[model samples]
Target chain A: MALTRNESAPLFSSDTANTLRLIAYLALAIALMVIDHRNGWLVQVRYFASAAVEPMYRLAALPSRLARSAGDAMSDRARLNTRNAELERELLLAQARLNRLQSVRDQNERLQQLLEAQRSLDLGVQLARIIDVDTDPFRHRVTIDAGARQGVAVGEAVLDAHGVMGQIVEVLPNTSTVMLITDPAHALPVKSERTGLRAIARGNGALDSLELQNVPISADIKPGDMLVTSGLGGHFPAGFPVGTIGSIRNDASGMFAVATVTPSAALDRSGEVLILHNLPDPVGPPAPAPAEGPPAESAPANKAPNP
Target chain B: MNRLRANDWLFWGSIAACYLLQLMPLPQAMLPLKPWWLALVLMYWTLEAPDYVSLGRAFVLGLVGDVFSGDLLGEQALRLCVFCFILLRFRARLRFFPMWQQALAVLALLLNDRIVLLAIRAADGQLVPAASYWLAPFVGMLAWPWVFLLLDDARARLRVRDA
Candidate 1:
């Protein structure tokens, strides 16, 4: 039998029913968005869904990897051989440098241990692999393979081989999302390593651009000025290299000048990152209770025992 | 013949496959160019098999897209509802049109959907400028004819098997 619509039925028939159902679903989605945006109740739901979808990502990525391998196998054998030889030579030089660096690092660690013994502080580092780029291009975020299970905490600084990338914004059980320095929502307190001029480095959501905002037009800032984390906010450690000034443009109507910064780190292509877990205590041990009298006078009785 | 059952199965299966494709991981370079693959598939089915597919199905699928993409939840659903409504209303005229003409129409529809999405996103405080955001529809337009042909072939095969 050929496909036919029953004539006696109204035009609104089955199609109309489907349209109504779609409208209902649409309404439900809107309600979900409102609830998610306002209450953050959907984060757990999103996490569970992401976990379910993670395997699909791995499966889809396999074909792309295979295609890349196929292309590598087919192209420029002689050039590949030459490149391999050059890489081997470079590897030898790198190994030599690494050996010397290890010796220096060992000496530095000994010195650091002595200093830490005097000062009394604990420090550590964790490495993580980039898993997925944010689905929204406008949001400069990346998910890393490390998460809460690995002691990866939100607000920890993320760095690449070169310098500071961003901070952990969200931590899941199996993954964490890093909000990069290039995301518009992210702001880091930064200072010029050269001039010591301080400003907030804000992300403009571009691949290579950051904005140093609220700087005086007359400030001694220029192109190529190095920017480093100021550590003023206590979110990120101080003295981490962040970016370098690219261009400074003075606003014609205002006292403030906008300076563009290119991040020192390869923010767009970093496959591996280190999360510095050394966040400083936000509130130093509650100021030792002020003594009612001179410490010598108040503690005279205890002093004999102390001696 | 089991044509009706086969067509129904293909219709539902293709819809699910399209959703799966949307969920698939793509590199940065390929991600932006990935058309609203599920939407395109739904559009195809709605046009080719109006008896089986309808605006409600498209809207529901759009809601799924919204959920999966983590976009403003109702945005995709609304866009899909409007798109399906328009397409269903013009189904007869659309089916008879030449391939190029049909592609142009699809391009217009996709552009409209993108604009609506952009507007809603802007209202939600996203700073998506008009220039870069419009590129997806152009890519979608380019892919439309191929998607149309592929789904049409599947539909024809199902019809033959039914006969």
Candidate 2:
């Protein structure tokens, strides 16, 4: 079975052509990464790759779907009946509450319209579906099925049923990735609903938890206090629920307090979200137009009286 | 030499098939168990046909893996090159080892590959501790025997058909 070196030489010798092909492949990969990171030249490539891989995901999930259906088919009739009865009871209670909320919402709408006359603000919203969770464990990000095609742009605010989730970071033709509020790199300006003290809320990458930075140890913040988006930054709108204060640990240095807040929105389990597209400017308001004419005769009369 | 040529095609084809399987979306529970099919394939070629595949191919395949997995550039490539170099240096002895010993060796190689990846991530200052991070190589080790047997059987059949 031992073959002479000459006889096996062709099988074992390093082929110059194959080596060149491999070197070419390596060079192409490096070039791709450079272009992708520096200039975003590979966005279309990533999009195409995602589209091509999506069908594979569907195909792989087929067995689980079959198993689930089989399990459902074999479920006991009595268990299904009991589950249905419980759901019906819960539905009735929810409907009763919803009826009361409907009337309250109508009254609020009228009040809001009256306020709008004083300062008109136009806003638009869109809905999107969650597609995938972040592949990197270090980042808290989710990919949504909506993308540039759906008018979802980077920096748009994403909100779930309860409150703000995060902002869109990357947008493709058919999908976009949202960097969730719980991402370690994310920070939002927040105001305590009770004290009106403004502080920055930063994500700790722990699901459902965030920390308020640089709050004075003696400040009037307590457990169970609510935090709302302060609208200091134009990134998010004002008055959206952010989180509730969980625990406060006053440092011996007394310079600051470490407070943990439970995020209002369920970051882990949400299936759908609303992308708020109409975010206002963060800096000073738009400048008013110059006087169109010389001082009017009634200008003095319209001016406020000196105390 | 003819027998070697037959195994080369069989092994390379199996590796391609494995890459396709890696693309298939398994259930969430099974996701962690999805083997490092590319690494297994690279290891096979490194051992069975070192002269043909060599260190450079392992490095290139690793780059392809990085692109497919959406990881940072050169992450998998560096790990695979190191793995292949080690395997290549000992290809002769590795080919003669018992099946169990070979699997153990592969497990060690994969563990080193993971460690190297973690080191790179740590250097970049992004660290997350999770048990699932180590799952891929263990699954790869478990799948090694089956992969080896299946490919070996196919190569034998192909050789007979060719003759």
Candidate 3:
């Protein structure tokens, strides 16, 4: 190769040039963050980046998947038989429970037909494996193996066997990120199962509790009452279990109550979750409370059936 | 030609292996002790073969790391560029340090990385992370000598011609 060594090359190679490059890169990064957070200019880029990194996630999950398969393979015949028997028994019990639910559903449909209420939510559960978890203190999230390819969409509710887990905030081609209900930025509309008292449950960035905001002190909600998605404004399907009200406190100002709810799902160990990809068609927002009846704050949920 | 390629493999291969290690998912309980694998590997190359891995390379690798780890845009990019800048400027001194002292220097760099991470998170309005978040750097520091020796041994055994 013939080298054309020019005097101009020295300027590009000098120490000052390197410093200039550093400053330029840092400036570029800062510009990216400012533009990204403000207008989400890089959201699509991030999504594509996530798709590009899907292989890394698969690589990361490979060992654990192998271990689990190996453990299952190594179990002795007797142990396998015992596990099968246990599962069969559980299935039988579940079927018996379903029989009762079948009758209740028929009753509900008949009543709904008479009342002309919007049809009930057809709860469809799709299984997904949690491939990666974000331990960032401020953003609690998990990446699932399901994505747009699996019909998972943003704003779809995710649940484990126990109860509501969170909702899909972002979807890539082959994977999706679920922002856990415990994340500070996440909020869900919920109602007291017993009193029909409505409130919005917002994550406090804590693992164990969600906070209820703007709940009036006069509201009849109490600790130990169950909260279910009311389907108001509709990010989640109606009647899904959200949490148990753990504690409630009247604020110092005396007008409103602050309540803490213990999440029903095991947020820490959700190995598998079911994504509710479709909201049972939401009935429009419920009739606002009468002026004379207590004022219950309802935040318009941006997506789904308010069943 | 084959010998130089082997040497390149020796350098890039170790970095790739470190990435694999970094990407592996650890149980929640063991997450805190996960070493800074990419940083350690990058440090090894920047000190031993400074001409091969440049600041642009580091910046790009950090962007990949950020996206793979699902961190905010440019968080890792900025952190890694700073890391490379410091390493390049002080390459002569850092290269001559005894193995033990080298580990200490790595500890310092990793600690700086942690501080930068905290500053970024705070600026993004995130709550302070747990004490456990600070443990990985120490773990990486302790693992440095072993990693350095292991890569050295592997390269020597392969008899890769130097670039």
Mind giving the per-residue lDDT tens digits that candidate 1 earns over B2-105?
77778778887887677656655465555566677776777787666666656656666776665555555566777877777777777767778898888888
What is the C-alpha lDDT profile of model 2 across A1-307, one tens digit per residue? 3234324533334342254544565565456555665676555565666665444334433554576679889999999999899978877866665656556556755776776731322344677876543344446777677888888888988877566799988776666778889887799899999989899999886767998877887789999999988766667767778899999996567788988989988787636777877433335664222111111111111111100
Q: What is the lDDT of residue A163 in candidate 3?
A: 73
Per-prediction fnat values? 0.23, 0.06, 0.31
The top-ranked prediction according to lDDT is 3
Off by over 4 Å in 2: A1-39, A48-53, A56-86, A93-122, A132-134, A212-215, A250-255, A278-307, B1-35, B48-64, B128-143, B146-163
- Expressed as tens digits, the lDDT of each residue in A47-131 for candidate 3 is 7776567877787678877887898899899999998999888778766666566666678657767877533233456788898
- lDDT, residue B124, model 2: 51
Model 1 spans with C-alpha error above 4 angstroms? A1-26, A85-97, A104-124, A132-134, A252-254, A278-307, B1-9, B16-32, B51-60, B161-163
Q: For residue A213, give model 3's deviation from the true position in Å.
A: 6.4
In candidate 1, which residue pairs clash? A18-B56, A19-B56, B3-B162
Best by DockQ: 3
TM-score of model 1 relative to the true fold?
A: 0.80
Give the least accurate 10-residue stretch of model 1 chain A, judged by summed lDDT: A298-307
lDDT of 2 by residue, B42-115 (tens): 76656554554665677667765555445565667767667766676666678788998899888898888788
